[model samples]
Target: MPVARPETSDARVIAHVDMDCFYVQVEQRKQPELRGLPTAVVQYNEWQGGALIAVSYEARSCGVKRSMRGEEATAACPEIQLVQVPVARGKADLNTYRSAGSEVVSILARSGRCERASIDEVYLDLTDAAESMLADAPPESLESIDEEALKSHILGMSREDGDDFKKSVRDWICRKGADRRDKLLGCGIIIVAELRKQVLKETEFSCSAGIAHNKMLAKLASGMNKPAQQTVVPYSAVQELLSSLPIKKMKQLGGKLGTSLQTDFGIDTVGDLLQFSETKLQEHYGVNTGTWLWNIARGISGEEVQGRLLPKSHGSGKTFPGPRALRSLSNVQHWLNQLCEELYERLSSDLEQNKRIASTLTLHASAFGSKDSDSHKKFPSKSCPLRYGVTKIQEDAFNLFQAALREYMGPFGTKPQGNKKETWRITGLSVSASKIVDIPSGTSSIMRYFQSQSTIPSCSTSGCLQEDVAVTPSASESCSEQKSVETQAAMPEEDISITDTLPDLDNSYGNMDMVPEKDVSCQSNDAKEFLTQSGSNRGTQTKTNGQRINNSKEKNKGMPSIVDIFKNYNATPQSQQETREDSTVSLTSKRANLSSSTSHSSEVNQEGEDRRETEWGYKVGEIDQAVFDELPYEIQREFRSFLRHNKRPNAGKSKGDGSASSSIAHYFPPLKK
Candidate 1:
C-alpha cells in the first residue's frame, strides 16, 4: 500500500544512473580478457552451472538473458564464458560488488545530493547544480556540447536516413530560446555525462544515466538506452513518449498492479489510464493510490532523491530447498551461527569505518510442519535487541528461532522435546540488524547533566514511571554546582580509577527515562561529585558521611524538591463537581510553595526552558520492553542508575524494584567512578 504525494511541480532536476550488467563488469575488471567476450556471472556453479545473475551486452545480443542458466547461455552462444560469484560461510558473497558500488557513489556524490537506490543504481537531485550551471554557463552560449552529452538518446526523436537524429538532439540540447526548465534539464544531461565519464575513468566501469525533471521520468528514460549511453527526457517530448507506452512498462506498475488495472478496467496503456476520472479511480483504489495513478498518467511524480550513502540495514541469509532442509535443532543452530558470523563481520567493519552501531536484530525463517496435513502453517518472525559480540548475536538468534518455532508448530504439531522424528523442517533462515545510530564523542556523561538541572521528571504520564519515587542531593549542594559537575562525565576522571565502568557504550535501553526512581543510586564519579561539592560548600567541617547526614537534617523544609513537583504534576484529575474546589486548593498550595522557595522554583523553570529547546520528546509508553531487555547488562545498569535516584525506601515499598536491580546487576560490577 503506497501513499500518494502532492502533485509534481517539475521544479527540480533528477537523474537515475544504473550500471549495465554490474556483476559482469566487476568480473571483467578482475580479468581484462573477458571485457569484449560474451560473459555471464553466476552463483553456486555446482548446480547446473549455477543461476545467471548478470549477462554481458555481447551475451544478450546472442539470445542469452539474466534468468537463463549457464548451461542454456553456453548453448545459445558456444563461446560464452561463465563466472561464479564469490562464496563465504556456505553462501554467495557480494562484498566485491558492494565495494565497487561504493567507488561509483564516491564519484557521483560530487555533483549533488545522491541516493544509492541499490547495489548498482543511484538517484541524484541535481537541481542546484543545474541552476548554478544555467546561471554561470548557459548551454546556449557554448559553441558545442561535450561529445558524451551529444551521444544521448532523446525520446520522441525519430531516426532517418540522413542522421537527422543527432542534429535533432544537438539542436534541442542547445536550443537558442528554450524554456528555463528545458535549459535546466539540458544542464543536467551534461552533468550526468561528465559523472559517467569520471566513473569510467576512475573505476574502469561504464554506466547509463537518464536526465529529467523528476525521478519517475528519469528512471523510465534511463532504461531506454542500453549500455554506455545516456538519455534525456525533455518536457515537450513527455506526452508523446508516454501516450503509446504500455502500462506494464511504467516504473512501479510492472507487476501485479499492472495486471489488476488491465483485468479490472481493460486498461493497457498510459493513455488509457487518463480516460478515467480521478474520482472514478478513487472509487476503485483508495484515495492515496487513486490520485497517484491519475497524476503519473500526466507525467507527474513528486518522489525526491534522499541524501544517503550507506544502507539502512545489514542482513545475511541462505535457503535450503526440499531435501536439503534442516531438521534437527543442532543443524539449525549451526547454520544460524554461520549467518551471525557474517552479520557480525559486516557490523564490525561498519563500526570501525563509520562509527555507527545497530540496535535491533531480527530473524526470519521459512518452514512448514511435515506431520500436519495443513502444511500452510507459516513460520513466525522474531527480533531482539542487537548487541556487539558474535556470541551474543548467535545466542539471540537461536532464541528467536526457538520463539518462532513454538508459534509455527501449534498444539497438535510435533514438539521439539518429543523423542519422535523432527516434524518441522527449516527451508530458509535470515538475520538482519537494523535501527542503526551514529555515536558522537563527548556524549558519555549526559546523565549527570540531567540530574544537576532537576530537569529529570520523577514521574511521567505513562504508567511506566511510578509517582512514589524520590531523589535529592544534600542541602549544601546547590543546583549550579551540579551543572558544573555534569561536565565531568564528558571527560576522563582525574581521581577514581574506575575505567572499567565506562566500557565504550553502544546504545541505551530503548528511550532512557529523564529522572531516577527511589531506591536506585549511581555510585559513579557523578555521585562523588555531590559529596565533594557539598563538603566544600559547608566549610570542610566534618567527616564526609557525617557532614552528609547533618546537611540532610538541616535542609530547608519549606523548599519544594524535585520529588514534590513531580508528585504534583502527576496528581489525578477530579470530577466536574469537585473541579473548582480542587483547582482553588491546588493554586493556593502552588503559590505558597513558590513564594517560600523562589530560588528552587527558578532552577526548575530554567530546567524546563532547556528541555523545550530539544527537537524531539518521547513518552514512557513508547519504549519497547522486549528490546530493552535484550540490551547488555552493563548498559542496563548504567541507564537504570540514571533513571532511579539513590533512596532507601520504607518496609512498605514495592518489592519489584529490588528484583529489577538483582536481575540487571547480575553480570555488572559494582558502580565505580
Candidate 2:
C-alpha cells in the first residue's frame, strides 16, 4: 500500500479567496446605487456575445443566472441592469476588472503568501496572520451594554474559545448543550463571520472562505457557504463530508471522468470511489490521471501554492460576433495585435515588480461555431531568453501567433468544404506566457530598500532570485543589450564557459506545468505556449516520459518547452546551422525555416487526414555550438540559469536512463531563504 505524505506544517499556507459575484461587485462598488439591484456584467451584446460573466446574487434570486443570454435576463427581470462586458480594441475588455482584481489581491497579500487565482479570486497562506489574530479579538463597541452581552452570549453558548470567532460559536454550541454535529455547524458559522469581517475591513471587498486542515478541504468548504461566509472542516469530518458529496463537486473531476464514475463504476459519490483499488482505477483511466484520481480520493494533494501576485502568464483576447466576424488573416492579425498589447503591458508589470521573465508565449483561437465546431486551434509557442523591452515581447508574441496559425489552419479540419466565407469569425482569441521565473540574480533596485525588512529566498550561486523581474532596459540600453546578446551569440565556443548562470542544455526536460493550489500562484493563463529563436518558422519537438497527459488541450502537458526550442534556436552553426560572419546564422536561418519543414503541423490540422508537408525555412539541425558559446555574458547567463531552474525538479529519469539522464534533467525547484 502506498502511504500518502501528510502536508508539512511549514511547507506553505494557501488560501483560496473568491470574491462574491466579482464583476457585479466591481460595478456595485463603483456605483453603489447598483447595490441590491439585479446587475450583470455582460460581454458581446450581439446574438453571439456570450451571456453574463457575472450576475449579482440578487439577480440570482430573481432567476437571473450567469451565461444567461442578455435577452433572457431582461425577460426574467425587466428591471435588471445588463452592462456590456466592455470591449477594447475588438475584444472583451477586461482591463478594468483585472485592475480591480489586482487591488483586492494586493490587500489580501499584505501579511503572507498570496496568489491571484483569477480576475476576482485570490489565495492567501495566512497561517501567520490567522495565528496572530487568534490571540486577540477586536475591542468591544461599547463597555457596558449588550456589546459584552453579545460577546458573553457568544462565548457562554459554546463554552469554547477557538482560534477566532468560531471558538466563540463553539462555546455557544456548548451552552446549547449541542452534539458534535451542532458544534461543528456553529464553528463553521463563526469562521465565516470572522473571515467576512476581516475581508471587508482589510480589502474593502467582501469574500468567502473555507477553513480546513488542507487546501482541498478548505476549497470545497469555501464554496459551501459563499459570498460572505466561511466553512470549517475539522480533521474528523473529512470522510463524512466526502461520502455523500456528488463526485462532480470535486475539482478536476469534470466532464468525462464524472461520466465514467457514474456509468462505469457506479461511483456516484466520492465515497464510492474508495471501493475501487488504485490499480483498478489505473486500468480504467490512464496512468497520470489514474494516480491523480487515487490521490485526490484519499484527500491527498501534493500540489504547492506559489507565492506570487502577478499572473503567472498574461493573456489578452477577444471574441468576434455575428457579421462583424473576421474575414481575412489581416483581420485576425489585427485583433491578435490588440491582445498581444495587453499581454505585453502585464508582462511589463511583472518585469517591473518581480524582475522576472516569461519563458514562453502561446496563442489560442476559437472560430465561429457555425463555421466548424471541430476547429479548436492552438498556435505554436515560441520563447527565447525573455528580453525586457515591450518591443521584444510584442514582436516575439506576434510572430508566434503567425506560426501557430499556419500550423492550426493547415493540420486542423480544413476550411469548411466549399464554404469560402471569411465569416470564419473567431469567437475567442487569447495570448499567454508560461514557465515564468524571477529575473536572475539578487534583488531589483526597487526592491533593495525593502530587502532588509523582508526575507527573500536564497538564490543560485550565480545570484538569480525569485524576486527579481526583468527591468525594461531603456531604449538605448535595450539596444545595448541586444548588441551584447548578438555579440555573445557570435562568441567562440572555446572562449565561453557555461556557468551556473547559464542553464546546461543537456539537462533540459519537457514542459511540466505546475498548477498552484493557491491564490497567489503564477498568474497568467497556462502562461501560453512559447519557444525560442525569435525570427519565425518556429515549430515543436516533443518528449513524453510515458506520462501521457490526460488532456492534450490543457496547458503544459509535459511537452518539450519553448526554452528547449530556444536552445535549438540558438544552436551554433557547426552543431546545426552553419555560421555567418563571426556568429552562427541560426536565428536568421531558423526564422526563415519556421513555416517549412515542420511535421508537427500536420498533427493539429484537425482531422488525421489531408496532410500537407509545408516547408519551413529553417533547418535547426545545422545550427552551431560556437554561437551558443558566444553571447553577452548576462543574457547567456540568464538563459542558462532559466533552463536550470525549470529542470531542477524531475532530476530523476525513467528505468534504464541511469543517474546520468536523471542528473541532466533541469527543474525549477525553489527553496526557503
Query: What does each candidate score in C-alpha RMSD?
Result: 16.4, 18.1
Error of 1 at 116 (Å): 0.7
lDDT of 1 by residue, 56-123 (tens): 99999999998888788889999999999999999998889998999999899999999999999999
lDDT by residue for model 2 (1-673), tens: 2223445644233456678888888878778888889898888767744588898888888998887898888888888987776776666777788888877776767666776767776665655554443334212211222221123222112334544554453344334544433343333333334455666776567777765545676678778766665555555567778888889888767687787788998888888888888788878786666776777676666655567788767777666655666655545656666776667666655654566556556666665444444555543343333333343344444434433433455433234343445324555667777667554333111111111101110011111211111111111121212222223223332221211111111112111111111111112323211221212111111111211111122112223322343333234313322222233223223222332233343332212111111211111111112222222223334444544444333233322423212111222223211
TM-score on alpha carbons, each prediction: 0.68, 0.56
Candidate 1 segments exceeding 4 Å error = 8-10, 160-165, 441-673
lDDT of 1 at 282: 85
Clashing residue pairs found in predicted model 1: 516-643, 516-644, 517-644, 517-645, 520-645
